[model samples]
Structure formats: C-alpha cells, structure tokens
Target chain A: MLEFTFSVILENLLLATRWTILLSLIAFVLGGVVGLIVLFARVSHSRALRTLTIGYIELFQGTPLLMQLFLFFFGVALLGVEVSPWVAASLALTFWTSAFLAEIWRGCVEAIPKGQWEASESLAMTYTEQMRHVILPQALRIAVAPTVGFSVQVIKGTALASVIGFVELTKAGTMLNNATFRPFLVYTLVALIYFALCFPLSWYSKRLEGRLNVAR
Target chain B: MLYQMNFGDLLPYWQVLARGLLFTVVLTLVSTVAGIFVGTAGAWARTFGPKWAGTCVSIYVELIRNTPFIVQLFFIFFGLPAIGVKMGEAEAAFLAMTINLGAYSTEIIRAGIQAVPYGHLEAGSSLAMSRWEIFRHIVLKQAFMKVYPALSSQIVIVMLGSAVVSQISAEDLTYAANYIQSRNFRAFEVYLVVTGIYLALAIALRALLRGIARAVFPKG
Candidate 1:
C-alpha cells in the first residue's frame, strides 16, 4: 500500500490550483461575453428575440452542469468532430455560466426604474445610446456584487470538468488519491484548496452587497 | 462531417430511461423534503441557539456551499467506507444531496425567518403561548409563505443537481443516458433525448411546487 505524505500532496495540490484558476477565468470571461449578448436579447424590443433568449436561459439553467459537460464532450465526438476535453469543458462551462450571469444581469437591468429609460428617451437618445450612456452605468452598480458572487459558482463548477477527463484540481486530487491510497486526505486538501480560491470571493461579495445596500 | 442522427436507435431503451426518470423524481422528492426540515432546523439553530452553535452552523453551511456536489458524493461514497460506514450508492447519494441541499436552504430559510414581522412574534407572546408554540404557530408558517418562491426555485436547482449522482453510478437519468450511449453508441442522440426529458421534468416540477404552494397557503 502506498502511503501519503501531507507535504508531498499539498505541494502538488497547490500547483494544480493554477489550472483551476485558469479554467475559472476562461469560463468567466467567455461566459460574460455570451451573457452580455443574451442579456441584450432578453431586453430587446423584439418579442421573438426575447422569447428565444428566455428559452436559452431556461434550457441551460434547468439542467445540471455535469450533464451539460457530458453532452458537450461525448455529443461532439458522436458528430465525428475530434475536440479536446479542454475545449469541450470550456464550451459547456461558458454556456452554463452565461445562462446564470445573463439572468443575474437581466435582474440588474430591470431593477433600474422605468423613469430612467423614459428620461433618456425624452432627451432623444436612441435605444443603443440610452443603453450605453444612461442605463447600463446605473445597472452596473447592482450587477457588481451579484456578478462577483456568481464567480464563486463558476469556480466551484470547474470541478465538474474533471469528470470529462479535464485535469483540473478535482481530477488531480482523484489521480493522486488513487496513487497514494489517501482518499480522505487528498479530498480534504482538494476541498481546502477550493475554499481558498472561493472563500475570498464569497467574502468580497458579501462586503459589496453590504455596501450596495447602504448606498440604496 | 455531420453524422446522420437516429434517435430511433434509442427507442428500445425507453424502459431504462423511464425507470431512471422515476428514480430521479423519487430521489428529488425525498431529498427536498428532508432538506427542508434540515434547513429549517439549521436556520432555527443559527438564529436562536448559542453563539458557538450558530458559528458552527455557519461553518457547515459555508463549507458545503463552496465545494462541488460531485466531490461531496465521492467523499461520502468512497471515503466513508474506509471508516467502516458502508452505504449503497443510492443511499450515499441521497445523504450527500440532503447535506448539500440543507446548507443552501439554510441560507434561504434564514432570510425568510428574519423577514417575519416582529409584531407577529409579539402578538404570539401576548397570547401567552410558549416559545415553541409561538415559533410553530406564527414564525415558521409566515416565514415559509414569504420564501416559497425562492425555496421552490432552490428545489428545482436541487432536482437538477440530482443528475450528478450518476457519477457514483446511481441509476438516475444521466446514468440511463450513459448506458444507452454505450449500448447504441448513439451518445449524442441519447443525451439530446435525456436533456429534453430533464427540461420537461423541471417545468413539471416547478408547476407542481406552485400548485402545492397555492393549496398550502392560499393567502400567500
């Protein structure tokens, strides 16, 4: 039986932590871009566009992120396209994160009162101009705390990419556990590393939420 | 090259898919009920118990909240056996789901409990009710009604989360998909079908929860 040492495992785990952060960043940025488009579509004057956006959000949000990852990874292969696990994982995470971030942002946009839109219109601002100049700036304040909070979800979600054979933090932990025969110790370190990555965002989110509430 | 899709190849496995769907529903229902109770109790403790007790509950909630459910399942299923507690895949999955749901619901329920009007508790006290009686009659019921929407949404999220138990080989919908994919080699079609089913199930579950809310709290 192979025995595990805390020092050896901890060092490896910390090194693997970089991949987790990298994945989270890729997922967040790509998801943010997609979410912006969805948010715009949702708020657009066209009913068809709005309904289509709603469908996209519901489909992504209503399903588990894990299943989504599987579908992307395995489903793409069935289409005779050779895609890497990294590409598949990123695509799935981007879609999942976009759905959630779009919803969060939609709420923020709508929270800006009708009067603001009306005032901007009265000033003869076009829809795009109003959105860019008048409305989004206000909505961005409401969006900040929740956006930061959602990043924690995004970070934790990177773990699911492991199941698809993406070698991130959780996958590394699993590999090390099998090699060292130390499931508990390896997973505890895995959990703690995730905590280290996530807890600060959670704290900052809470702080921002408090500040936002005070401003309101 | 786009492969010609044949969902018909998956037709024979409908029975497996049905059984998996049933298990998913049953697992979700049991866990959501159990989770609500656990969450309510945890919220109560956090709100009314000693400082240390509240702090401990806070820690528990934070730990579960920040970690992935897949990791939690593996820890329970694989790690617990080393300590001599052996549970079947389904049981361990349910236990983990309960713990995971409890942590999330605790935060939601705490917000609901705190939102209860102070006047209601005072009114109960003036009626000479005991503390538990006041809590049960006034605080709990009102808090539940206020948080019903958020709580129901959380339940849907939990139900969707149940799909992850397939990782530990629990015979849920995703497991059925895996089986059908392996058998037919129609991985894409099987998943597409399963995704549609999950979407329908989620909508149906939300409608069911809304119906229950109407029946339970008409005023709400």
Candidate 2:
C-alpha cells in the first residue's frame, strides 16, 4: 500500500472538482432548454397542455432526486442498455433541473400583470407573438437572479451523482477518505471546496436580488 | 429483453417498507419540530438579538446553506467520530437534517420577522407589552403567519432530502428500497414503488401542512 499524504488527497479532490463543475454546466444548460419548453407548455392557451405540464413539474418536484438517479441508473439497465454513471447522472439531473427551472420561470412569467397579455392580445398579437414580443422579455429580467440562485442548487445536486459512482468531488472525497483514513480532514476539505464554489454564486444572486428589488 | 415489472415481488417485504416509511416520517417529524425551534431562535438572534449573536447566526446559516446536506451528514457521521464526538447513524441523520432545515428556516423566518410592520411594534409597545411579550405575542406570530407557506415547503424539501440519510445506514424508505433490490434483483420495481411513495408522501405532507396552517392561522 502506498502512502497517502494530505497534498495527494487535495490534488485528487481538485481534479474531481472538474467533473462537478462540468456536470453542473451540462445540467444547467440542458435543463434550461427543456425547462423553457415546459414553461411554454405550462403557459400555453390549451388547457390540456397546461395540465400535462403541471403534472410533469409536480412529478419531478415531489420526488427525491436521489431516487431519480437510481431509476436512471438501475432502472435503465433493466431495458438492456448499459448506462454509465456519468450518463445516468446527467440524464437524471437534466430532468430534475428542468422541472425546478420550469417552475421558477413560470412564477416569473406569471408575475407579469394580466393586463400585458390582454393588451398584447387586443393589438391582434397571437400567443407566440405576445410571448416573443411582450411577456418573455420582461419575464427574463426577473428570471435572471432566481435562475442564477437555483444553479447553486444544481451544483449541490450534483453531489448526489456521487452516490451513483459518478466520481465527482464528493465521490473523490469519499475515495480519498477510504485511502487516507482521514475522514475529518478529507470531508472538511470536500465541504469547503463545495462552499467555495457555491458561496460566490449565492452572494452574487443575493446582490442581484437586492438590485432587482431596488429597481422596482 | 423487455423488463417485466413485478411489484408482487415487493409484497413479501411490505413490513420492511412500512417500517422504513414510519422511520422516515418519524425522523422528519422530530427533526422538523426541533429544526423550527432552532430556526426561530436563530431568526430572533438575527433580527432582534445582539450583534455578535446575529453575526454568528448568519455564519451558521450561510455555511449550512452553501454546502450540500450529504457532505454535512458525512462530516457528522464519519468525521465527528474522529474527534471523539461519536453518534449512531440515525442520530447523525437527525442532527444533520435539523441543522440543514434550521439554516433555511432561519433565513425564511427572518424575512418574515423583518416584514413585520414597524407600526405593529409600536402598537404592542403602546399596549404596555414588554419587549419579550411584544416579540412573542405580536412579532413572532405574525412573522410565522407571513412565512408559513414557505416554511412548509422548506420542510417538505428537507423530508425529501432525507432520502440521502439512507446512505449513512439510517434505514429510511430509500434504504428499504435498496435493501429489497439487493435481495430480489428488482431494482426497477423497487425504485419505482419507492418513488411513487415519495411522491404520495410529499403530496400528503403538503396537504397536512396546509390543514395545519388553516387551523393555526385561521385568518390566513
């Protein structure tokens, strides 16, 4: 057995941090696109589409993400497809992030007064026209801060991917602890690294929120 | 090969599942009650207590809020033992959940406390209410009334997050699912059923909280 030093463990954790960042990026960007579709469906003029979207959002929001990861990991294997932890974690996280982002953006869009929709409609604008020319642009402004704030959640969420053996920062921390037998030092560093990644985003989001409130 | 869904295989483990569900519920109930108390005190410190206490509370909130709950659990369960602060898995899970929820609810409750109108404090003062009396009777109740929905949602989120506690061998609903899957090789069915239970639990918990809100805050 080779000796495990503090520096060796730290170096390994730093390398694993890359995956955490990449997974967060993949989930956030993809979830944003899918969440936009869900948002549109949620706000669509058709009641059926709106209802279906609500169920979609509710299903994702209500269930635990850890279980979702398990379903994607072990559940997909039942279908004869070999799923890697990376693929399963990404897929599960994308869907989970989409659900939450959709809900958050829905709140933002709904925050627009009803009169804007009516006024745009009276101008002979169609639904798409109103959304493109009127509502979404305004909603996008309010959506920015909370959307950024939610990315902290997405980053924290990738920690669950470790449970599925995704080898992210948390996974690396556990492995190093196993190797080094220094759970206290290893996990503390893991937490501080997560906090370092997350705290700036959280601070920035709060500042943005403050500025938004003042602008109002 | 198409996978056959056999929930019947899980029928034999009904007791295991039920026990797990009961444990999860009990854990949530205990931690939530305790967490809210911590949150209220933390909120009071942040809003009305001394400066050092407020800063300390703010640090605690941010540190917990910024990190993931699982890491916190690992730290308490796996790491704390190194410093001679040992505990069982369930105890560690309970403590971590309470700390996590306390941080979140502190922020939530502080917002509510701050939103309490200055005029209400004046009214309480005019009524000859003591400082503690004003906070207890006027400020705290109104703050809770204002943020009750947000608090309930946070509670539900904490409950859902509690699934991770199973990782520490806490034997939550997720642990039961994992255990059954290991025995019967019914991963898909087990997870699907567990996920459904979680969804049902989330919905029922929300409804229960709503009922409590209605009973507790009759005007709201």
Best by TM-score: 2
Residue pairs in candidate 2 whose N, alpha carbon or C atoms collide under 3 angstroms: none
How well is each residue in A1-216 modelled by candidate 1, as lDDT tens digits? 544578888888888888899999999999999999899899988999999999999999988888798889987776688979898999999999999999999999999999999999999998888889988899999899999999999998999888889998988998988888878778888888898888899989999999999987
- What clash count goes with each model? 0, 0
Clashing pairs in 1: none
* Tens-place lDDT digits, model 2, residues A31-99: 999999999899999999999999999999999999999999997788798999999999999999999
Candidate 2 on B158-202: residue-level lDDT in tens?
999999999999999999999999999988899999999999999
| Over 4 Å off, model 2 | none
TM-score of predicted model 1? Answer: 0.97
Quote the B-chain TM-score, candidate 1: 0.97
Candidate 1 clashes: the total is: 0
